[model samples]
Target: MNTKLLFSIAMILSISIITLMCFLSPAHAKSSTSPNIVLIISDDAGYADFGFQGSKIIETPNIDAIAKSGVTFTRGYVSAPVCAPSRAGLLTGRYQQRFSFERNLTTKEDLNRGIAQSEKTMGDHFKALGYRTAAIGKWHLGNKDVYHPNNRGFDHFYGLLDGSRDYFKQVIKKPADKYKVLQRNGELLTETTGYVTDLLTNETIDFIERNKTQPFFAYVSYTAVHTPMHAQAHRLTAVPESVVDPKRRKLIAMTASLDDNIGRIIAKLDQLGLSENTLVVFLNDNGGALTNASINAPLRGYKGSTFEGAIRVPMVVKWPGHIKENSHYDQTVISLDLLPTLLAAANAKPIENTPTIDGKNLLPYLSGANASSPHESIFFKYHSGRAHIKGDWKWMTTKLKQADGSKKLFKFLFNLKNDPAEQNNLLNSHPEKVTELRLEWQDWFFDMPGIWTQL
Candidate 1:
């Protein structure tokens, strides 16, 4: 070969090698040190409502895609059986009862009530690590400014301050209509067009695109299929023909919209080449609600009850390269685990002087590095009712009203592994097991403040 031709070929090979190296270098790829986090929460959703959870009627292709892409916890639970407290537990990584956020806010007088200001939220944890955080959709934590998302670690907030609102309309019909108006950061949006589910999704995509270069924590809280049975008129046609009830059809339509938006968020992540580096978690705030025409079939009771139907929710976590696709974790997991898990994923330490986190970091367990369950037992306390679960055994205490306006306390036990329905109460049969669980529950109960203690 000629000298000139040999030199030309060598130079070409060198250029090609450098190009490949640049394409694979850290500068060209997403930073693994700070993974973006997107937490998508649905309000009052059913356990058996989505395609991933074996639903044949209500199609949730996008949500199912999340399950297909990562791990689905079959025995997932939330700290509370209701909205406000469940969210408190999720964001704080500790039981809401620990901070005296035990019940839902009802009247205008309860405006000041919220997750304790001292507690750090998941957004706080991520923001401390330099993440640009935004909270979209529902903010049922509190109506007061002190408990606002901006004050609770999120940099931007756009959503309702109350627990529920009209999805299509946001006009203030009265002086006490503060919860009806949508707030963008600190400003209240007098008017908003389009459905809320779509609106929230748009904000989420916008946040991701604007902050693609930096780590962002987008909390997409959707109050869909919650109440008033409000859904886009055209979406009703998308519901299955088999669903005859009008209310149920509306709920199905709302769920369909929610699923579509979730798909959009995932698509946005993929489009920005952040899918592999973003941790996306989808779960319901609690379980299906009685008023929303939701179906928590195969599980007993509905929202506000301590049964599996109220507490057990459909939870899926997706981190393209970290969590194995199409994986399933049958052992118990809770919404409280989110903060610790995200912190672990980002290699961020817990905030200084914060209370001990009740949730365990689940990365090791989800990655199969550890075979044992993330928790030895999980406890639940709502009003006079309480429950404790250890291994496959579950013990519960329910408060029932008598004929003469008196309340009666009842105890029940069940081997959840054999009977998940909670149909057979083994309280009498397993007296010793009940004693063990009762004692354990008492210890947990005493450690946390009493109901409305903070108020």
Candidate 2:
């Protein structure tokens, strides 16, 4: 063959090899070195309410798509069973109880109550590493200025500082309703209109677009399907006829809206060409609430209780190049692990001179580098109730009021692997297991500060 012809053939072969390598390489190989983190949290959502969690009545296609593309933790749990405390644990990557944030603040008067100022939130950690951070939606951590999102390290904040709020502007009759009124970086926006869910989604998309060039940690917390049974009239009409209860129908509509907004966020990521390097996490702040007709079927107890239904929430994590598609982690994992996971993804470490975090980095476990569970034992304590989970066994105690107006402490045990519903108690049958769990709980409780605020 001629020398020119041989040179052309060799060049073609080289080009073909390069193209094949690019196609087969992991997702991260084609993306930026540092990953952008988007943590999307839904409030008071049920475990069985979304398409990903096997819901037939409430549709969540967008959220389900995330599950299909990432890893789903079937036994995932939050550090606490309620809103404020659970969020404290989630953002700080520590058990809230350690900072004396055990109970939910009932009234707006408890301004002093919030996540301890000493704890470093997810935003704080990410910001220190040069990532732009934003917190949107519910900011239940604290209403106090000291505990505000801006003070906690977020560059931008848009949401309510209180726990619950009316979904529509018309419903918010009082202009000075601190809990219901929307705020942007401490500025109260009394004239804000439209569905809060959609508004929060807009803020998230804007943050992503503005910071597309750099790494960002966007905490998109949505307060949907929570309380007041407020659903848009049009959305309510979309609910299936099979849902008989008016409240449940409203809940369905609200959930559907939430799912739609999640889809919008995901679409925004794709549109910006940031999906490959963005880590999207979806989970409820806690479990389904007792009101609002939210159902936590197959799991015993509701929000505010030390039961699987209240603590075990639906959690999904998606990182295109990192986590395998349609993966499921059945072992016990808690929301507290999110911070450490994000840090590990950013190739960053926890800030020095800070207290040890309770959460473990889940990347190794999720990637098959580590076979053992991320947590050996997860503990819970709230008010008069307490619970502990080690391996498959869960030991719990509940305070029951008697007819005579006295209170009695009741203890129960169950092997979640067999009875996730907690219908069958093995407390009497397995005294040794109960004793072991009790001792462990005691040690954990001993280290925790007492409840800092009155409920």
Candidate 3:
């Protein structure tokens, strides 16, 4: 080879290195080198809907595999009972109540479903850390372009901007035009005939293939099992019509599709040689609804209620090398923990001048060095009434849904550990505990934003 030719090759390589550094270096993106993070969120999945959580009705073998391969939190929790607010809390790592967020993401009816720009999100932090981020599937956090996923640190955004859309419709972005789907940051391609769940999985797999060479963050938010009752026919073959009740058959179909999609993603992770290196966190946005016939067994109340059914959710984290396999942690963990945990795993430092975070890094707690509860007391304020859970005692107002579609708040207390089903109300027996929790809730809500939205 001639010296001139060698020099030319070196020049080209140096330029390429500079360009790559501009995109991946911490000075440019504020991130540390770590494993890829894939967050798989299910919409409206019931506590007992999956097999791992003691459900016999629906068979979710692949999701169960994550439990066998990683850590499963028995007392995992979501911040809210609804999709929009729950996501807001999860992404922001703060209480949605702290910002007076009470409505769905659909702003067409004067309801804004997204979070305010003032509050920082996990995506924002990750993006700063030089990670290429993509958000696939349901983005009910916001419908407007300014509030879209791309605008909030995600470099790529696919799926519907609205909470729900027609599944079979070939065109989601431009249903009338045929195959032109909404494309934000050149990531999402409009589907023409595939089921929504399958389509989401396809996009995710495409992302993995495209960005496998570098660190990437994929947020696959499955819009499964939420209202519209539409799912692909292929994934719903084994259901017995008798067992699959008429009112919930559509939901069952959606659930099956979601499971298959998860299977595909998990399979792809292994195929792409990223399974052991990727940190996968699976969770539901909120509690199940009786309206959809999702039974939240072994727990009282439903979605939008201040019961274990509403807040407690299935949280599984799988990272073969980092987390212990087949381990179950009984300590209560919150959705807010995701932010610090992910950053900690990535070796990314927190911002110096940020507000106080209500979440704690679960690594130490899960490892058993930390003995205290994540929070000594947790405050719950749905409406005018307030409740607090401290140690084993819980005090709250029972807002019974009346026949006329109104709520009747009844104040009471219960020892959750003693009576997990909340069958026994110890308000009379434990007056002191109730008083203590009440004082705590009041003080917590005092500095909160101007309260409204309560019915």
Candidate 4:
């Protein structure tokens, strides 16, 4: 054989191998390194709680900085009005009910139920892109070994597995209480000390320092402003009794402490010079808890109800060069979009076996590349309550129990563009619009795999 012919064949084979390698690894195939992502999810924060959102009593300068640095989403929402289901939707980029996760899991139910193992999380997507992944605060998704954070593509995990925990030492009272303590990578930490917020913040800063040289994704899901409203004595004393109601003083202090830690997180990013290269997202798991004295004023309802105050939340995203500084995007966006959007930013390719996600890539609308809303409609269902929003029109249906032990169905329709508070019900007057939105909700609800959707 001719030597020239052999060399030609060798070069052809080498080129083919390189092309296949690129196709297999999309992350490394990109010309430039993708930015780091830091997702900060606060527990039960009200729509008007942040300083940037006109909170007169609670000062949140650091949380407000996120809005100042990038885009503040005035019409953001989560899939569910509660914790477990909402977190499931956010983490998996899909409607939780699509996989039988429609309601908050009880402590016993959590042992057997969670975000399914087949569902790939945002951490799984980022990990495929060669980015270090860590889940810092709350991990209410599940307590079983299969649903653990480490098993879900997170390289590091520091938090509790249950819905809530004590800020200081978590003493196991009942058998169910065993799932509520702090842990590092799934192992219980016996000597955990300090306030939960501060300790979590320290771990976050340390994680950033350790991985400053590489791209990473930090999911900081804080349990702040939640129940067991324990706050440091100093923070409580700082608030004057005359400025606000005595009942709300502790919640205010807890919120203040959370704000201070947020400041620490931002400062750490700046110190490591990772600010410009990092995409920071700050939002709430759901709406505020009215019983907790959270001020969700101007918006009706509270945390477990299907009202504007329960689903709609404050979302701020800061990406230095990509998103405009201090801009406000009024279009509706949901927690389901976070994974797809983050993976797109990371240049990560979707796997063939991964389940289909309901979220859209929000970059086009968020960056002005597209001028329309990210979604045409959003739907929610928890027990006997159901809600749907299309454009500016909103429809809600609830089952009220009567004194005779019977249930009554009440429907409401409101034009959110004009009445953001949902004060009036137009279901009778706008029968046509009511039928349209209700039909849409029925289609979505029935399509879900949960038991509640069986009918």
In terms of lDDT, model 2 sits at 0.88
Q: After superposition, how far is residue 48 of candidate 1 from its true place, in Å?
A: 0.3
Candidate that scores best on TM-score: 4
Query: What is candidate 3's lDDT per residue for 1-455, written digit by digit as tens?
Result: 99999999999999999989786676444323488899999988788888889987677888899888889988788877778778877887787777666546443443343566666777787778777789888777765456778888788887776666667764434432321244446444553466677878998999998988778889888877777677556545666557757646666667777887899999998998888789999999878877677767798778777788877888999877778899998777788888888888887866554456677788777667787777677666555445677777778885787999998878778888887678898888878887888888888877877533421
lDDT of 2 by residue, 1-455 (tens): 99999999999999999988875543323235679999999999887899888888888999999999999999899988899899989999999888888878775456678888778888888887778899999888877788889999899999998777888873455533675578889898988899989999999999899988877889999989789778899988888888899988989999989999999999999998889989999999878987978888889888988889899999999999799999999989999899989989987799875679999999999999999998889999888889999999999998766999998998999999999999999998999999999999999889677777322
How do the residues 125-214 of candidate 4 rate in per-residue lDDT, one tens digit apiece?
888777889999899887778888999989999988888889888788787776778899968886788999998899999999998877
Candidate 3, pairs of clashing residues: 29-128, 30-129, 31-129, 105-113, 170-191, 170-192
Report the Cα lDDT for residue 408, model 2: 93
lDDT of 1: 0.88
List candidate 1 segments past 4 Å from native.
Answer: 1-32, 400-408
Better of 1 and 4 by lDDT: 1
Candidate 4 has a TM-score of: 0.92
Which residue runs of candidate 2 sit more than 4 Å off their true CA positions?
1-31, 107-109, 170-176, 400-408, 453-455
Stretches of candidate 3 off by over 4 Å are 1-24, 27-33, 106-113, 170-183, 186-191, 241-244, 451-455
> Candidate 4, 174: how far from true, in Å?
2.2
Q: Give all candidates' CA lDDT scores.
A: 0.88, 0.88, 0.76, 0.87
Q: What's the candidate order when arranged by decreasing TM-score?
A: 4, 1, 2, 3
Task: Between candidates 1 and 3, name the one with more favorable lDDT.
Answer: 1
Clashing pairs in 2: none
Residue 40 CA displacement from its true place in model 3, Å = 0.8
Q: Which tens-of-lDDT digit does each residue in 1-455 have in candidate 1? A: 99999999999999999989865653233344668889999999988999999889988999999999999999999999999999999999999998899888887667768888778888787777778889998888887778889999999898888878888888677875877578799798876787888988998899899999888889999988789689888898877788999999998999999999999999999898988889899999888988988889899889997888999999999897899999999999999898999888887778886788999999999888999999999999888779999999999977766999998888789899999999999999999999999999889888777766674
